[model samples]
Target: MRFMWLPIVESVRMYLQSLPEIAETYEVDLIGNLPKGGGSSIEIDWEAERGAAETVNTTGAVAVHLLIKHRTDDTDIWRAFREQYRIQNLILQEIRRLHDYILTNLKIAVKISATGVEPLGDMVRPYYGNELILVFEWKGAIRDGRYES
Candidate 1:
């Protein structure tokens, strides 16, 4: 398929990439709708949690998924688990950082409903040495369409 470009999504990607914690680790890559691969990448992917009608004003939800991976040389089971734990915690910290960033900067006004983290297993396409998925749920008022007489 041909490459697709989205300006709004790119803006979102830049927002994630600009985060100090995330940038310090690696060049922030916005996975967008593309498949994940490449050794050790930090990516931000988000989707509308549900469809919305064409209304003047309404609330909507967006599920933001943060994917983080760091290649490690440690092979021992215990050491790997410890490394995984560390990466998971760091990613969570970064997610918190992003949440705060959005609250402070995004004046459109979105409420973060929930946050969570889960392990992405090694068998995945990315084939991570250590993988973690951080989830942030954001709810905000959306204005769509024009009011008719």
Candidate 2:
């Protein structure tokens, strides 16, 4: 059985990279994984949860965590907050596009389960960001001793 995490994550990264607002504005890697060190950038993290399985098929869910981070030296806290909000909205706009893309292209069903915003750094560090959680459910069929999406 081939796990779907790698393909799904790669597809998401590619889709996000196609967006100029994300690719041009932030420092995204070729594969969209988090960089070695933290800076102003966008990254992705994911986990898979297996569900009930039958003899011929199985069900599961994958949670993709979209992290958007921005750092500024400006002392104006409001400006930092505003920038983060703007970035968040930019990401939100692409979510629908991504959902449809996954369904149409990857043939997988995805859902936006939840979203969250929180401070990344304290008064000393100047980092601001939020984490958007997207949960995607998938079904796989077992054929010839192998699994197919």
Candidate 3:
């Protein structure tokens, strides 16, 4: 039994580097090794809405959440991560596009849940080896109160 999620571990450096504003906007703390969190026993620190330019928080704002989960084996984790890598790359390249689209197209509020959606996007973690990455995102922007329903 071999447990290795090096792909995701390796990609974190590049992924964080890719988004410089993330660090500047919100407080980010990297959690090494799995902790007593929810499922997967993995914990990562991320502050949503880092360096937001013009967050539209309104009364009628509707929040939407997006999610992507990868299921695979520990040794086969690379395959799942590859799929997410491309997706993240696309998102990175067209981040502005999504931002613009949300404003113009989606009338209601929008939020995305990248929880456990690591840049590596791998599943089938080894029960023994502590190798994991978690990605998270806020759904939408509303008033001072959080947006629900």
Candidate 4:
């Protein structure tokens, strides 16, 4: 609820604002643990198929349940981010900039892993709760940015 210095909070806010850039750089509609964002949005679903585990291609919505977080303790967050074309490229630039800042200045590394679930057979049926959890790891490095033991 308080701060010893202003730079601490300001630095935190800067890091928080970099979420959108990171997501777009990785070609994902949304990403990161956004501090206090996500206001309003919409979700778009399409049909597509073809993965390493599939024999015959299937057709279904190529989207997942857009994550919406509660703004406050009482109000529920109904935001569903729909993929947009025009802004993605611009966002990527910012992502890369943030990445550089993290790598060169912050001396930190980030990794993300994502998984998905599909129908056992090809039926093109609507499935429930098919998604994956992306884990992000930030390994802090030394001042020289070398691997820290």
Which of the numbered candidates is closest to the native, going by highest TM-score?
2
Q: Scored by CA lDDT, what does every candidate get?
A: 0.47, 0.67, 0.34, 0.29
Q: Name the top lDDT candidate.
A: 2
lDDT (0-100) at residue 94 of candidate 4? Answer: 48
Error of 2 at 17 (Å): 1.3
The positional error of residue 120 in candidate 3, measured at the CA in angstroms, is: 11
Report residue 142 deviation for candidate 4 (angstroms).
1.9
- Compare candidates 1 and 4 on lDDT and give the better one: 1
Worst 10 residues of 1 by lDDT: 1-10
Model 2, range 44-78, lDDT digits (tens) per residue? 78875656444555556777777767777778878
lDDT of 3 by residue, 24-83 (tens): 322222354323322222223333323234345332211212222323445775665664
lDDT per residue, candidate 1, 27-54, as tens digits? 4566544345444555666665442442
Could you tell me the C-alpha RMSD of candidate 1 in Å? 6.8
Model 4 has a clash total of 0
Q: Which residue pairs clash within candidate 2?
A: none
TM-scores for candidates 1 onward, in order: 0.56, 0.73, 0.28, 0.27
**Alpha-carbon lDDT of model 3:** 0.34
Give stretches of model 1 more than 4 Å off: 1-16, 19-21, 32-39, 49-51, 77-84, 94-106, 113-115, 122-149
